[model samples]
Structure formats: structure tokens, C-alpha cells
Target: MKQQQVKLISLVMVAVFAISLVLAACAVPATAPSAPAGGEAASTDVAAPEAAAPAADSNFKPVWYAPAPHPYFEEVRKGVEAFEAETGIKVEKQIGPDWNQDSQNQRMEALAAQGFNAFSVYPADAVGTNGLYEQLTPNGIHIINFGTSTAQPTTASFAVATDVKAAAMRAAEELIAAMGGKGNIINVLEVLEDPNTALRKQGIDEVVAKYPDVTIIQEVADIKSVEEAVQKVGDALSANIDKVDGIIATGYTPSVAIAQVLSEYKEKGGDRTIHAVGIDTDEMVMQAIKDGVMDGTIVQNPYGHGYLSMLLLQYLSEGYTPKADAYFVDAGFAFATQENLETYNNDILAVTEQIKSELLDKYLEK
Candidate 1:
């Protein structure tokens, strides 16, 4: 009986010690910080603790790719960085050497082979990009076109972009207003291959046709680079320097060229007002607006393009599906003049916030 009692005491002691160790292990340390409320991970320059990261699937690898370098792509990258900071999801970003479909296919296929499951790509060729999408989506890859859409009947899950037609029409309206409602316009377009370019041209044409007083006297197309834009736009301006009343560029390269060439025209003592409106907020474009050289610009939400596409991809990884007819998401755009030049980004950001709030209810179905 004595030996049994001694054994029982030893067993009880072991149990008690084990309980104490378990309690200690489960206890929250006094110095350990609590996670931020609402489960948003605190953004910091240093790496976050492993436990702080929210439970995204291990295979939700994502990438952000642009066909080539441009100021607009750089702006879109800011939104991507913001998404990474907010969600703690790393995105691989790549800019190809040229705006070529073959280059994009080679690089992106290699990435897919390496296990990237989601991509946000700016389609180099709207029709050709659909082929790559067809190849990838069947194998369970998700693609979101950030800056523009692929041709219709596409395999891309969604396109987060400004409505090309609407933005072009808005640019046309702004230019006509700047021209005092009656003037000759030099229509500048970029890369003929981009699907957006065709829609933009149609929109501009439609808008111009509505006004009997406004005429598009000269049009320059197929602009590939800033240098090419400068040369072509300068040639157009010199050819119609006397009759051209306003210049409008619906593309980024031509927009930047407009600002540069027009600034030089003013410096060289050209007297015509040459009212102008373009798209995107390049520093040169904004400064031209401030200097009264160019009238204004149509500001597309590139930031929203980056952030919203990634947000959708994140939701997709979380088992959410896009609702029927939710393929073309208009990220929204604003018209920026000298009055709102410095503060227009706030408007764009607000659009992003509004869109973010509506994503679950409006665009996605679990």
C-alpha cells in the first residue's frame, strides 16, 4: 500500500508539471504585441513575423508585368507596391525589352513553368495575348489585364482599365472646349497594334463628328517611342502650323511628345495658342498645363489598375469567382487641368477606395 501511494504521488506530480508547462506555452507574453485590429498587418520596412501574415494559400504566387518601360507603368507599380504592403503578398514584377507579343510569351511562359499561378499583365497585342491566356487559364492560372483588355472572347478573368472609348471622348470634349468650340485638331495616336488604340480612335472620331465647328484636319498614328512621337508630331504641327487650332493626344507617348514639342514651339516664338489636351499626368504634361502651353489631360487611374487587379487575384485565390458580366472593370479616370493638377491624384485614389469597397459586393461571387 505504501509503495502504491508513493507511485501515485509521483504520477500526480508529473501531471501537474506537464499542465504547468502547457499553460506557460499557451500564455501570451507581456512584451508580445497584439496584432492590429481588423486583421490588417502593420506595414513596416522590416520583415513581419511569420504568424502575422494572414492565411493565404501557399500557392498564390502572383506577378505584375509590363511590356516595356514607361512613366505610366512606373505609376502603376506604385499601386502594386501598396497592395504588397497591405496584404503581405509578394508579387514578381517584370518589364520586357520591347512591346512584342513573342517576347511576352517567352518570358511569361518561363514564369508559369516556375510555378507562378497568377499574373497581372498589360497585353502587348490584344488578339495575340488571348492565345497566351488560353494556354495558361486551362492549367489553373489566373490572369488579369491591368492597363488594357485583350480582344473580346478572351480567357483573361478580368480587365482593370479605364474605358478607352469614354476616356477618348472626354479628351475630345476637353480639347474642343479649350479650342473655344471651333477649331482644327491634329489627332495623335500611339501604337496601331494596341486594341485600345482602335477604340480610342473610334471614340475621338465619334466625338469630333458631333460638332460641326470642330474638324480633325491632320492625324498622325503608329507612334512607338517618345522620339518617334516628337518627330511625327513636330512634322504634323509644322505642316498645319497656320490652320491647326488645337492638338489632342489620347495616348501616353504622344501626350508626352505634345508637351515637349509644344513647349519648344512656344520658346521659339510661335504665336498660335494651339490649344491642347492629352492623357496621363507626366511631369512634362503637368508643367505644360501650368505654363499655359497645353490645356489639360485625361488622367487614367494607373494606380487602381495595379491595386485592383491584384486585389481581384487575391480574392480569386481565396475561392471567390467573378460574377457574370464582370469581366471589364472600368477603374475610372479624371480630367486634370492646371486647377487640379497638384491634387488630382487624390481623386484617383478615392476612386480606388470606392472600387475596393465594392469589389466583394459588385464584382465577385464566392
Candidate 2:
């Protein structure tokens, strides 16, 4: 009986041990390590971090270009810089060598290749620049004419320049007034290649015609540089000094030249009071006004020209279309004489403010 009891106990113990081994095998994973409590395995299920988005203003690539380096362009450039400072928008600014259409074409094409989509340009040739604009506009590029305009039937979105004809007329009126409405005038013009020169010439001529006594005794044009203008204007003055009573310069280079020449002519004690009027408020010209060597100058809003054109280009770039009737925007103009020299800028700024307030509702289709 005792042997039977011992054997039964031993058999029961062996069965229990076998059952424990089987249960342990079923509870744990046999071949692989288990994942965490609520997620996929760290070693194989990691997700990549998302990339950072690009800056909003970085996509805009605008360029402000002048056909050549001039003091007027330099002042306009100040306005461009002011815009950048105000808006925090960047621009690629350039001034080409000589005022030529071909060079403008080449440089613009190169810039286009580098991904500049907007331009504030002084059109090199009034008629020929349209061909370039045609090419650019088709490819989603925008253009605005500053300082002077391309010819009508143009592809340029807008022109933010002085009314060249009107300004010229004003300059002529000032010159005629100083001449006492009776004198032989010397019409000094800059590059005939520029269409504005022709318009200016016609304005001067029409004004002269109104006063029959004021005849244009000598006309000297194709004055490309200050040096050339000095020589040409000096020659005109020397040749017709006896009869030349009033001098009018309608372009920047010529205006500056006239200021210098007239100042020197006065310093040298030239007896004749050859009254003069010019366009622009060049430092020399302004000084001449102060010295009473010049009668007056037509002060165009070059700062407004620079600031407004850039603002327009920015708007037009962002899906705004020009109104059908919107073309030439006379930025504004004023006659700056010595008497009103200090106050001219305030008047011009008023014009700028008025135009800016109207731009959205009046000029754009949105």
C-alpha cells in the first residue's frame, strides 16, 4: 500500500511539471521581440519630419533698370531704396552703359533667364522697346515705364513719368516769360533717338509760335553728353550770342549742361543776360536758380516716378489687371523757380499722394 501511494505522488508531480512547460511556451513570442504597449515598433516604424515652408517674399524677383547712369536716375534710385526699406522687398537694380535699345535687350534677356519677372524700365527706344515688351509679357513678365514712356500702342502696363509735352510747354513758357516775350531762342535738345525729345521740341515750338516775337533762331540737338552739350550749346551761344536772348533745355543732360555753361558764362562776366529755363532740379540747376543765372526749371516727380512704378508692378504681379482706359499716368509736374524752390517738393508730394489714393479704384481692374 505504501509503495503504491509513493508511485502515484511521483506520477502526479511529473504531469504538473509538463503542463507548466507548455503554458510558458504559449505565453511568450517564440521567434520575434514584441512591440510596445500601444504603438508600432520603434526600430522599423519611424516617420520622417516634414520640410520647412519657403518665405513669402522670397519668390518676388523685381528689377529696377535705367538705360544709363545719370544723376536723375541716381535720385530715382533713392526712391527705389525707400520702397525696399518700407516694404522689406528686395530688388535687383541696374544701370546700363549707354542708352541703346540693343544693350537693353541683351541685359534684360539675361535677367529674364535668371528669373526676374518684373521690371521698372526707362525705355531705350520708344518704338523698338515694344518688341521686347511683347516677348516678355507673353511669358508672364510685367513692365512699367519710368521717367519717359514707350510709344503708344505699347505693351507696358503703365507710365509713371511727367507729362513730357506739358512739362516742355511749361519750360518754354518760363523761358519766354524771362525773355520778356520777345527774343531769339536757342533750343537745346538731347538725343533725337528718344521720342520724348521730339515731343519736347514740338512743345517748345508751339509755345514759341504763340509769341511771334520769340523765334527759335538756332536749334542744336543730338547732345549725348554734358561735354557735347557744352560744346554744342557754347557754339550756339557764341555763334548767335548777339541775338540769343533766351535758352531752353528740355532734357536732363542738356539741362545740366545749360546750368554749368550759363553759370560759367556769368562768372566770366558775359554782358548779355541770356535768360534760361530747363527741366529737372539737378543740384547744379538749383544752384543756378539760387544765383539768378537760370529763370526756372520744370521739376518732375522723379521720386514719385520711382516709388509708384514699383508699387504698380507689385500690384500687377499679384493678379491685378490694368483698366482698359488706364495707360499713361502723369506722375505730376511743377515749375520750380527760385521763389518756389523750397516749396516745389511739397506740391509734387501732394500729387503723389493724390495719385496713390486713386490707383486701386481708378487704374486697376483687380
Candidate 3:
């Protein structure tokens, strides 16, 4: 009986030990590792960190293009940079080797192939650029004209540029005023290929017609470079130095050339008071104004051009469409004379801010 009791106690001990082993096996962690497919063991190493969230506006790829390098483009680039900084969207900025539609077409096509879906372009040739746009827009690319507009009936969504005719008329009026409303004028034009040239010429001509005494004695155009402008303007001035009373340059290259040539003319003691008005405020142009060599300049908002075009592209990418009849967005311009030279930029900035405030209501639709 004693031997039987000992054996029974030992069996009870064994049973308790077996139960403890079962409980220990059951007490797994609350979070068991999920088995991979095919009954594979879960990875023991820590999982890699999740990929970083995509950048804001990353879905929209934008390209800012200039036909060629110019001071105006540099200023516009500042606005593009500002947009990038504000929205955290990178712009693929490009400058072509030359201001030709062929160059633009080739480069733009390559960019499109690389997945750029939006473009802010300075139309190299106003009419020719529309052809390229026709090809691009069909493929779901959005285009905004930044510095100048393509010819009418275009595929571009919007033109964020100055009213070229109005600005030119204003420039002419200013020149006429400086000339005391009646004088012989030398009209200097830039590339004839540019569509803006025709409008500017018309503006100047209409304004001149209003004052019968102010005759355009000589018209010099086809100025592709500042050097050419200097040569031609110098020749025209030399020929009419005694009779010519006012000069007007309605293009960027000629405007700069006029400033430079007039400054030199004054420095060389050319006593004639050649009243001059030009468009675009290059540093030399502004200095000429300060020095009283140039009468004034029409300052277009290049910064606005850069910022507003990109903003429009961004909105278009985000499901907003341009409002009806909102194809031409006048970015506005200012006449910068010596009186307001120091503060004219403030006026231009005011214009930009106003336009920005109206983008949603005036320019775009959901």
C-alpha cells in the first residue's frame, strides 16, 4: 500500500509538470508574427521604413521655357523661383539656343516625351508656335504664354502678358508728350517676325496720327541684336540729328539699345535733346532715366509673367479650368519715368497681387 501511494504521488507530479509545459507553449506574445505566403516564416528583421510621402504638386510636371537668354527672362525666373518655393514644386526651366520655332519645337517635343505635362513658353514666333501647341495640347499638355501670346485661335490655355498694343500706345503718347506733342520721330522696331511688333507699330502709328505734326520721318526695324540697333539708330540719328525730336523703342532689345546709344550720345557732348521712350526696364535703361538720357520706359511685370503662368498651370493640373473668355490675362504694365523710377516696382507688384487675388474668381473655374 505504501509503494502504491508513492507511485501515485510521482504520477501526479509528472502530470503537473506536463500541464506547466502546455501552458508555457500557449503563452505566446499577444502579437504573433503573420506568416508570409506559402507558409514561409515571417521575417525576423525589422521591416523597412515606408517610402516617404510624395511632394506637394508632384503630379504636375511643369516646364518654364525661354526662347533665349535675356534680362527679362532672368527677372521672370525670379517669379518662377518664388512659385517653386511657395508650392514646393520644381519647374524644369529651359533656355533655347536661339529664338526660333524650330528650336522650340524640338526641345519641347523632347520635354513632352519625358513626361512634362505643362509649359510656360515665350513664343519664338507668334504664329508658328501655335503649330507646336496643336501637337502638344492633343496629348493632354497644358500651355500658358508667359511673355507674349501666340497668334489668335491658339491652343494655349492663357496668355499672361502685357497688352502689347496698349503699352505701345502709352509709350508713344509718353514720347509725344516729351516732344511737346509735335516733332519728327524715329521709330525703331525689333524683329519683324515677332507678332508683337505689328501691334506696337500700329499703336505708335495711331498715336502719331492723332498728332499730325508728329510725323514718323524714318522707320528702322529688323533689329535682331542691340549691336544692330545701335548701328541703325546711330545712322538714323546722324542723318536726322538736327530735325528728329523724339525716338521710340517698343521692343526689349531696341529699348536697351536706345538707352545705351543715348547715354553715349550725351557723354560725347551731342547737345541735341533727343527725347526717347522705350519698353522694358533694363538696368542700363533705368540708369539712363536717372541720368536724364532716356525720358522713360514702359515696365512690364516679368515677375508676374513667371508667377502667374505657373500658378495657372498648377491650377489646371489640379482640375481647375480657365473661365470663359479668360484666355488673355493682362499682367499689366507701368510707365517708369524718373519721377517714379524708384517706386515703380511697387506699382507692378501691386498689380501682381491684385491679379493673384482674382485668379480663382476672375481667371479660373473648377
Pairs of residues clashing in candidate 2: none
Best by TM-score: 1
TM-score for each of the candidates: 0.82, 0.79, 0.81
Candidate 1 residue lDDT tens string, 83-133: 787777899999898889999999999999999999999998889999999
- Pull out the clashing pairs in model 1: none
- In model 3, the worst 10-residue window by lDDT is 36-45
lDDT against the true structure, per candidate, is: 0.85, 0.81, 0.84
Instruction: Give the range where candidate 1 is weakest over 10 consecutive residues by summed lDDT.
Output: 36-45
Give the lDDT of residue 55 in candidate 2: 33
- Residues 1-366 of candidate 2 have per-residue lDDT tens digits of 699999999999998998988886675541133321111112122211122212325557899999886656765776676666666788899999888899999999899999999999998888889999999988889999998888888889998899988989989988898888898999999998777788899999999999988899999999877899989988988999788899999987888889898899999999998999988766788889889999888887777788788878888877788998788888988887878866666677678678877787788877
Model 1 regions lying over 4 Å from their true place: 1-55
**Candidate 2 local accuracy as lDDT?**
0.81
